[model samples]
Target: MKSSESRLGQWPLLAEAARRDRLGQALLLVGDEKGCQSAATALARWRLCEGSGEEACNCRSCRRQLDAHPDMRHVRPETKTIRLASVQQAVASSQSAPLWSPMTVLWFDPVTAMTLEAETALLKSLEEPEATTQYLLTAERRDQVLPTVVSRCQIVHLQGSIRASRPFRPEYLADRGRDLQEDLTAAAEAVRGRYLQRPDPRLLELFDVLVEAHGGIDRNLNQELTRETVAMWWRQTVGPD
Candidate 1:
């Protein structure tokens, strides 16, 4: 896997923000987890770096960030969900000044994993922006995130080249009929191939719909309904052939 700085180079808007020191206090990065993580780390390094360009400088702050700086705080859920205690800790940390760097970064990966109470607590901090602090939130899917939290931050959608090392397989349809499963498998492969080739917004949207439909099936949703949803997404995104 590539570093966040290297991965972020493909995104012009985000790269420009980091390089020009124009990044906002709150940022909601939506897309693949790997890319989002790299972008978040790249943004943090850019903010702390003393160099003139967008890339990280060889300054003390940049060096410390590379090695995990003390001022950089990471808030992650211990279990499957983020607790309110974690949000409180992050909020408290945001109030303090940076120990070494010019700015303090609070990175929350998979922000959608946060519980309602945790999100509420984090919302309060976002409402009152801090000058010397930056909040970076990454989500694999945007729709799963709270609208209020989404509204408080600048949203960045990232798309990177999809590696073909792992081919598409419809494992979620294991309990479905064999024929239906075979059809879905073929559809999944087609969508995956198109996405790998182009990686356009339409294909990304279709991919998100496929992921949601898979989750819907796991939750005991109507199999026919899920199948229809996937079919609709395929028609709308990829169309015929």
Candidate 2:
């Protein structure tokens, strides 16, 4: 584990689990996006490090891995979902020895983004793993994942990211569609939590757009159209509108 006084803090339990070879076949790390990604990256670097088994975070291998070396496979969504091809590629790579070392480290960030087919393909590999392959999977919401996959892994809940602020009053979202409510609630919580340094004029514009999306989704408008409208609005709201 890294020093407790370090900015990254210590993860003695995870370190011990890895040392004991009790990290299970698959490690499911659950947290908000930022926290999950950070933790996953740190763990991956630790595993790849040559200086210290517990992730000294100062070794040459650790530096390269954290900086995203070619040998360290990072599987993520190229589009909305993780295609079966991605899983196949990862599995194939896992079978091979490391490009730079003896161990292969694969980080499947946001593993839930994987499509059903991709996930099933991944299961086969997980069921029969190579002695040198290491897998780290992260997810924001586990309920969205397939139970079969969930059951195969050791769930490591990492409650590091800040939570979503309480949603807008249910009455405020009463007429909204489930999707719009989710979006508005996210936006409202972001703004209310003071995530932005200062109120952007575009934020007011986004609020207006969310109002419109809520109405459209509620009215059963065209799903594609509603999504596009809301996306454009969000882009403008978050961008230099």
Candidate 3:
């Protein structure tokens, strides 16, 4: 029930939640990485700040020993998505006592990308509460999560880092991807469209360049070299005209 505006023009709306004693055992923070992390860090700091006036802080929760933290377990995705094995390990570790703080935080940054199976395995832990454990799950979008899982926690919206998008002239060619051939083909179509509008011989030459690259694919030519050729051509083709 907080406004869209961020706290300090950066952090998430966590003041109201903390004031009302409504920071749930399982909290779902929805937004960009920076804001959600700021809120999570604020929560951690607030808890530790009570005991330590300053440094020599008896709160040994966040001292980075190699890769692990004592009272916090950050469950990161293996590659593109969180795996069931990672969730299971965090769930199993959830039972252990917090070495420093009163509660332990198990954080999953942007749980939206979690695979169906991984989310299912995590769903149980979210639904069931542990007296000494706090679940901090983040997401870029709320819709990415399972409805049942979303229902079980206190949802906090955050102001993520807004980035300015690089301008792309051809709308169709804007969605270029890793596949060099696919993007080159789209660029060729872009050039054809340009030629239709302006009747430029240069565009026809660009179209031929893309076609020549496509031709190489049939000959089992070196893709990396061909892609580099197209990239250099594209760079040289743009600007001042």
RMSD of each: 9.3, 14.3, 17.4
Query: How do the residues 1-241 of candidate 2 rate in per-residue lDDT, one tens digit apiece?
Result: 4332122234333443454354555777877888788777766665566654443446567566354665678888897888999889878977877766446777787888888888898788888888788788898876776777777776655552234454543233334455454555455445434325776766655655654554354345676676666666555556523
* TM-score ranking, high to low: 1, 2, 3
All candidates' lDDT scores?
0.66, 0.62, 0.62
Off by over 4 Å in 3: 1-13, 47-58, 62-67, 160-241
Report the CA-based lDDT of candidate 2 relative to the real structure. Answer: 0.62
Better of 1 and 2 by lDDT: 1
Question: How much is the lDDT of residue 216 in candidate 2?
Answer: 50
Instruction: Report the C-alpha lDDT of model 3 over 40-87, residue by residue, as the tens digit.
Output: 665544443325312244435434441266666788878889888988
Indicate the residue-level lDDT of 124 in model 3.
85
Compose the digit string of candidate 1's lDDT tens values, residues 149-186: 87787776554222222333344334355444334434
lDDT of 1: 0.66
Model 3, residue 199: distance off in Å is: 73
TM-score of each: 0.60, 0.59, 0.55
Give the number of the best model, judged by lDDT: 1
Supply every candidate's count of residue pairs whose N, Cα or C atoms clash at under 3 angstroms.
1, 0, 0
Model 2: per-residue Cα lDDT at residue 169: 37
